[model samples]
Target: MSEFFAHRRPGRPGLAVFVNAGDPPLALLPELVAMLDENEVDCLELAVPFPGSATDGPVVRASADRALATGVTPRAVLDTVASVRPGLRRLRIALLADWSHTVRGTAPGEFAAAARDAGCDGLLLHGVPPRLRTAHYEAVRRAGLPLVTTCYAVSGPDAVAEAVEHGSAYLYLVAHYGRSGTAAAWDRKRLGAVTATLRSAASAPVAVGFGVRTATDIEFLEGLGAEAAVVGSAGVARMEQARAAGRDPVGELQSFVRELRTPQPSHTPADGRKRGIHP
Candidate 1:
């Protein structure tokens, strides 16, 4: 298990924030990661720049663009992560995997090793087969990193249950089957059922993402036994707002995080674990 996941066992859902490395700029990353830690994000997933993120929506795709435009290569991303990691003991990072096949002579093991050396907590391996090869998973395991996978566009209870049984280090449940955005009202009942099914099947905690935007959304996920709710578009919106208002984006982000982490009462997970506003 990754140190971060081991620190908190497989009970309640845990919040994991996805940030595009070099989004604002390479120089501003450390401060941004620090602010996220201060705001109570349990884990952070940094998306390394790729030419095409077919699954990402406007908010994240634009983030990718900025990062690539600034010449955010794998080495640079790893260096940035290493520089900032020493101070962020509470924040475990997951490196986003994309377009790995296109890299000449680069194996999946190489990417996992790079992430581990950069002090990442886990590997968010996207686009791989659902039933991953033992060698592939072992490659990540060798680096002391857990593998987190997403059930994108999948909504069946049985399917979710099966995913959990696979020893998923953590389950990334997409809030929408489509692209990422700022979502308002969600199908709480349906989501609740899915959460229940996932809890029943997997020992790993499950998190909801892709469309979560507000505190209410977070609260609803909490009610359903979701360990975490990720808000990407909203964060980008806040950054854009800060840029327009001529305020420091990082400063604005601090306030935004405060609002998101506001506490609430205990909720029940499908596994019957009590949910606390621990982070």
Candidate 2:
């Protein structure tokens, strides 16, 4: 089983934290990574800063801007991962989508290979492109890198079901419609229903993201049968706040993870069969 899958089975949902490489500084990234690992994070998603980030809101976009200001590129992010790779055991690193493809060109295979060589375990293509043209997704998966594709509420439940049928290594469910926030804007009841339908059809793990800023947000997803919760803007924003406050940023992060890992009562799905955690 993949490291991601292995972490999600039979217990609680895996917490996948996202960090923008070069946000604080490239030199500080490895230490930040070590902090997350010490906190027992299941997987890490490293955002390779790009010039443009359409899917990201103000918080993430601002961080990306700062990273770009520091000249953080895809290569820089890979280098950071390479330095910390040897120290990790059973950890998966997923590279965020390439900016160029989102705006300019087609998906870049070489870019994916570069990330793989640098010890990245997967790829996260942010939005489900209009004409998905699964060629590149297939290429990266063939190379042993699981490509995660997201389906939002606006895409409708049918699209979500179809994504599962087509074989997403992981199906990203956007619970919230807009910017990352302290409270979830998504309709919990509706999202739960959609999640139920998707889980019934999806061949892969269904992970929730977007505006999932707190442990409470996670509890909601777990209840809905999601196997993983993606926390990005919240964690990154917290990391920045810690830095600005002159606190031990890493220590603070470790504490945050502990809160996330706390056990919660599982919810029985609508189908009556309890869904196993997606390790």
Candidate 3:
């Protein structure tokens, strides 16, 4: 099993936090990773910025813009990961990038090799569907790194199965059919159905993302049988908010993560049985 999925507990959902590489500056990455590691963030996703990212929302786009303006290239992101790996002893690190950023100008094999050497345990390629992932899979396989893929609710059962088959680490299920950051309310009924389908088909742990924001959301995901909950845009928004207020961004992020992982009270159902917040 991949280290990412191996860290998940059966009933409690793991927390994964996303941060864009070199968002403010690359010099701060090691400290940020160390803080996250100290706070029990199960996974750290280092998002590599590209000019044309279809999956990014306004918050993430702004972060990417700031990083790009400072000349944060793919090579720089990898080097930052390599430098910070020793401090992240208990955290599983994954690199999030599109195929364009992964390939750059070299072959996929060469790109995957560099990422593995940089201390990334897995890779998540955004916007690539499962049916079209054979070449990417082979390249990463040759490099000895596990590849993670996304499965959408609209993709239906067969697509979910195919995604699970192609994905070696874990499968990311889009909680809603949209971009990264949106204020739309989550449909619990629909999410339950989708999670049921995915759990039936997926052999590895299934993680939900794209609309998760709060501790309540994490509890809901745990109720739906999701192994992990990914918080992306909200994390970046908190960091940006702290920076604008002249407060320490890392401290704000640490508090936000601690709040997200804190358990809430569970309510009694119609059966008159009390259940905890998590499954």
Candidate 4:
């Protein structure tokens, strides 16, 4: 395990948030990351924007579109992450790249090396074809970068095996099969067995995503034997809403992160408005 997860103790179920590289604009991203770090976000999955992601829903897709419209490239994303890494005291960044759109032209080993040099703690290659899995795994191994492997909660044994075997930094156990963060409700009985299976097999930390919105959900995941709960769509949506309302995007996002970490059943900010973090 990388130092990122190595230092995380068995308390405060890890909170990982996702954000597009340039959605808040590259210039302001460092500030956002700083806010996340100060507010105790365990990890940030920084994505290089691409179109038509199969796992993304409207909120995330719109965030990606906003980022791509500003002409954010994969290299630019790395540079931006590198700039924030020095200042981060706790937050670890995992570079999330779409394999076809962002990494197809680059050599796998070269891309992995670039991410490492940019101070990323881990690399998550999204939308990778199964036939090319060996090459991707080898590249990360050669670069000595931690790998964040993912599989759906309902995936077959082969998929589960692949994730557990290669996953070093963490394992992203997606909660459902549909687009990310679109599930109406979680089936606790079904997920309990899956979470238990992953915890038993994976040496890395197990973090579950998909429809994980509130602290209640986070607590529930912890209860189910997961090490962390990942909130993507809701996190991105908070930033967009802040931007639209002419509020401080980083400050607003920090508030959302604070809500997730708090152990209260009813989360109320200073303003006392009830915020729903649904995807």
Each model's C-alpha lDDT? Answer: 0.69, 0.71, 0.80, 0.84
Candidate ordering by TM-score (highest first): 4, 3, 2, 1
lDDT of 3 by residue, 95-141 (tens): 88877555645776777788899998888877554464777778888
- Tell me the tens digit of each residue's lDDT in model 2 across 202-241: 7777778887666766876787788889988887788778
Better of 3 and 4 by TM-score: 4
Model 3 accuracy (lDDT, Cα): 0.80
TM-score of each: 0.82, 0.83, 0.90, 0.92
Pairs of residues clashing in candidate 1: 13-227, 14-227
lDDT of candidate 2 at residue 236, scale 0 to 100:
75
* Cα lDDT tens digits for candidate 4, 1-279: 245544455676887899889988988998888888888778999898999998899999999998999998888888888887888888989889888997888877788899999999998999888899998898888899999999886889998999999998899998877887585566666677889998998888899898988887887778788888889998888889999999988888888888887786655466643332211
Top candidate (lDDT): 4
Off by more than 4 A, model 3: 8-10, 102-104, 129-132, 267-279
Candidate 3 lDDT score at position 97: 80
Ranked candidates, highest lDDT first = 4, 3, 2, 1
Residue 17 in model 4: shift from native, Å?
A: 0.6
Off by over 4 Å in 4: 265-279
